[model samples]
Target: MLLGSMARRVLANAEGERRAPRFVFVIQSNGFDAVQACPESIPFQKYADREKFEQLDLTQHKLPKGLAALEPLKGKTTIVQGLSGRSTGGGHSTHGGCLGLYRTSPASRSAHNATIDYELGRAAPGILPWIGVGMSAGQGDALMHYTARAPHKSMPIILSPEKAYNAYFSVAAGGDREKDFHLKRNLLDYMIGDVKKTRRALGSLGGEELDAYLSAYDELAARQYRLLANKDTLGKSAPKLDDRFTSDVATKRL
Candidate 1:
């Protein structure tokens, strides 16, 4: 999550402008039946005959049982289908393969390459650029591994609504925005200085690692500066805390 914010800030700092067209990837790990997502009015047998390209008018047809909830917003929604994903490999679960277009192994349990979400996140900048929130049946830790930030690196999903709320709305907590801002600013300044000192005393490989660290800290500092400048606007737009925001349930997190 921190990496995502820093990446966005870095892009803004480099370009001297904020980029439009932000992205949010809502990944559902569980398998979904494609037939159930299609319109009920469309015959499955006819649709399966994929020898040629075809387009269906959803307006004239009733939505499938699974997608009935979207009826109210169907006019605004675009349902895309008939896309081939054979290049990603066939399996019960494509894992990171569907996004990266590379085969992933359960035994390895890590991405062999960077996923599409990370690529888009790097291009678009925001306060919390790429938020990974979802429900999981797994126990112990609330983080459900989803997209990969880089090769062999899995991005952690926040499975708890309470934790996710705290992370996103920490600035609005206790109505002490000025104090929180200064504390973060001071911390970033300290880390930036420490990284610079360490980078000067390191070898080429070590220096390279420190350089990345330095860039992240620099971007964070810049983000802090911007936040401070827009503190009033932030407070005005901040969400109000409620039962939904404080809930620990996995479904609520979604």
Candidate 2:
């Protein structure tokens, strides 16, 4: 969610006024049947001819049953196939390696070195770099997934839509901006002092790491202050809340 928005923002900023390309990745837990998604108008045997590349004009052909819902978006929709994921270890799940393009196993430590999403997020920084949302079946409040942040670091997905909404959009919702700014300012001041105290107690190497962390917090605080200063502008673009945000059904929340 965050990645998509950031990408959109990047595209908007690139061309001064022209619309930019946007990307969205809709990943499902269970695998999807590729055959079912293929257009019936295209001969399946054509795929067997590895000697030649084939392209189909989907605009002239009826969409596959699985993709019928996208009929309205035919002009913008694209169907790409024949990509291989053989290099990624396959099981019930690929864990972090799915996006990282590395072999990651449950038993292995430091398996996921890096992921494409995080790399992209780093390249295009936003108010919220990345937002991961998921729905678990019978997990009972436990948000377990194979996503990763960095090597040996598993990223946590927000399972609850309400929580996700609050995390990302709360600032844009109507509120007393002055009060919020003061509260955040006080909190950041306290955190800076605490980080300094902790750094003083640490050794040289640890202190250096703490210094970096503290600097990051300082940068974040500055960004937050700037955002709060422009609360009126942001609030105009805030998303409207509805029942789906608080729905218990995973699909509704998603």
Candidate 3:
């Protein structure tokens, strides 16, 4: 079990008030195209976020009936394609698809190391932001989650449906959106709390990466903190998430 999983199980016995969530996001990798093949998936043409397909004419880019099964999720997804993460990983075949998910830079040099997932998670490891799943095969070496520049510590991918289900259903140390405010507010507070100690430990100056990394972390914390305290974060305004926001019901040929 992941460390967070264990913590939640232990915390289950505690008595406390329930808290609303700050946000929720999902990632369905290579299997998404396969899932889209479901007759149910065709409705995804209706997805609202980042509607790159909004202008597409179904007749030209027809989806297969296999996608129809995924229709129920049409309004909730952000169907993205051709998003370049990086390039190089395992040549044209083996399984480089994972690397392309979000590397952003060229694959040759853009290390998927400690990707955003980890940065976000480590940013707040308590919540376990990255609920990982592997499709058709195992979780593989690449991290479904990542830091800004580095790939997460490599672990075998979760390649089975049963494994995915188990991970998804397992208990976890849940984070409360309301309670998160203090944590976010204090992130810098806590870090800066020891600024003198940190300075003393590091001596007169810090390196470029450390300085930049700290600034980035601070910016992230401040934004999240302010968003939470002020209730100013963006909503799930995508038309697919809520149809009323959409311009029209997209009618596709396939």
Candidate 4:
């Protein structure tokens, strides 16, 4: 009986050690042709109707040329076709509405509702709840809003990997990077103080805009402190800085 109890405890421990599954959404702007991800084993003629639900097991079939790199992970991958978001607007991109399932355009700055990615990020909260990294063809573009947290709220996609790295891992990185991290923390402290003073000066006249500014500053300052508090633990697992992080090439940065 003791041996059986020990075995059950071991099994429970193993189950508890299992990591949570991560969900990743790969989106493409400028109209991604679904044919690019279609399996080579299936003929294009088979999909001409485009009115039926079709599923392909990646493990049993060869991936298309564009997705050839994912061959090794084919067994774990799934390719679904015939899904459409007609309400997202007709254009090269839907901006915020693609994930929110509402009508929005490139000129629109906000979303009609929280996107799936944002909801998932909230459900699986991290030190930084959701980190978005992307690259733009345009030169010197530092960010793009591709996701939304709620109505009138948009998430910033980090276009510069360097900036993203600094935001994520700099606190644990030694040398000048660590110093810079502390410097930013100190700046946040100063800014928080200044914001408090500004709030006092403006009184009720400050309105929601000033309150929003103060809230943003407070959130950033809190993050800085949290990182500093966990620096020792973070240092053990932080990724080492490499050329890929600083690369100018869009693909490499991604």
The candidate maximizing TM-score is: 4
Error of 2 at 151 (Å): 2.8
How do all the candidates rank in terms of lDDT, highest first?
A: 4, 1, 2, 3
Candidate 1 residue runs with Cα over 4 Å from true position: 1-19, 46-48, 65-69, 84-86, 92-94, 107-113, 121-128, 139-145, 149-154, 176-185, 205-230, 251-254
Clashing pairs counted in every model: 0, 0, 47, 0
Model 1: per-residue Cα lDDT over 154-245, one tens digit each = 76677666665544455555556446657878999999999888877775756556776787788668767766665566667767667875
Residue-by-residue lDDT tens digits, candidate 4, 1-254: 53784677678778895333356666776766788978888877445666766566678888999889889998767777666777788676677777778887757747788888879877876565566777777736355456877677677777777787787788988889889999998998898899889889989988898887787788778878877887887888777678988787778875
Q: Which scores better on TM-score, 2 or 3?
A: 2
Candidate 1 CA-lDDT value: 0.67
The global C-alpha lDDT for each of the candidates, from Candidate 1 onward, is 0.67, 0.65, 0.40, 0.76
Off by over 4 Å in 3: 1-66, 69-87, 91-177, 200-205, 229-254
In model 2, the runs with Cα more than 4 Å from the true position are: 1-15, 18-21, 43-51, 65-69, 109-111, 125-127, 140-149, 175-189, 205-234
- Arranged by TM-score, best first: 4, 2, 1, 3
Q: Report the CA-based lDDT of candidate 2 relative to the real structure.
A: 0.65
Please give each candidate's TM-score: 0.69, 0.71, 0.35, 0.81
Residue 252's C-alpha lDDT in candidate 1? 64
- Error of model 4, residue 225, in angstroms: 3.6
Superior candidate under lDDT, 1 versus 3 = 1
